[model samples]
Target: MPPVKKIVMWLVVIFLLYAIFTSPDSAADIFGSAWDVVANGVRNIGRFFDSLISRS
Candidate 1:
């Protein structure tokens, strides 16, 4: 990308991250959502492996 576009993108990302981290509700909501996604992903992967083993 061009230098100006790159700078703008970085600035926007930084602003969003700052806003998220500074706002207590936003930070907690984001953390909770992320944790739920990770937990569900791990559970699904474990189930997949268990099913594979059963089939074999």
Candidate 2:
């Protein structure tokens, strides 16, 4: 792995640890919000595909 990638990964790990130790509730909220955004995008894509299939 590249040095930059290692450094970035380490930084992310440290930040996560800090967040978890300091405010676990907020950390959980953050993950939940991110998941919702991903799920919404996936649903939108599925709707688009369904519309295309209906048209054909």
Candidate 3:
């Protein structure tokens, strides 16, 4: 990866670590919401492909 991208990634990692250690509840909530969003996106993509197949 590029240098700037690496630096930004490190900063995000540090922040997440701080959040996890200092306030675990908030961290869990944040991660849970992120996972929910990803799951929904994947489900939507599957539905879209299923619809296309049915139409053909």
Best by TM-score: 2
Q: Tell me the spans in candidate 3 whose CA falls farther than 4 Å from its real position.
A: none
Q: Model 2, range 1-56, lDDT digits (tens) per residue?
A: 69999999999999999998999999999999999999999999999999999998
lDDT score, candidate 1: 0.92
- lDDT for each candidate structure: 0.92, 0.98, 0.97
The stretch of ten residues in a row with the least summed lDDT in candidate 1 is 19-28
Q: Rate residue 43 of model 1 by lDDT.
A: 100
- In order, how many clashes per candidate? 0, 0, 0
Q: Per-residue lDDT of 1-56 in model 1, one digit per residue for the tens?
A: 69999999999999878978789798778789999999999999999999999998
The alpha-carbon RMSD values of the candidates against the true structure, listed in the order shown, are: 3.0, 1.3, 1.6
In candidate 1, the residue pairs with backbone N, CA or C atoms under 3 Å apart (3 or more residues apart, or in different chains) clash, namely: none
The candidate that wins on lDDT is 2
Q: What TM-score does prediction 2 earn?
A: 0.89
Q: Candidate 2, clashing residue pairs? A: none
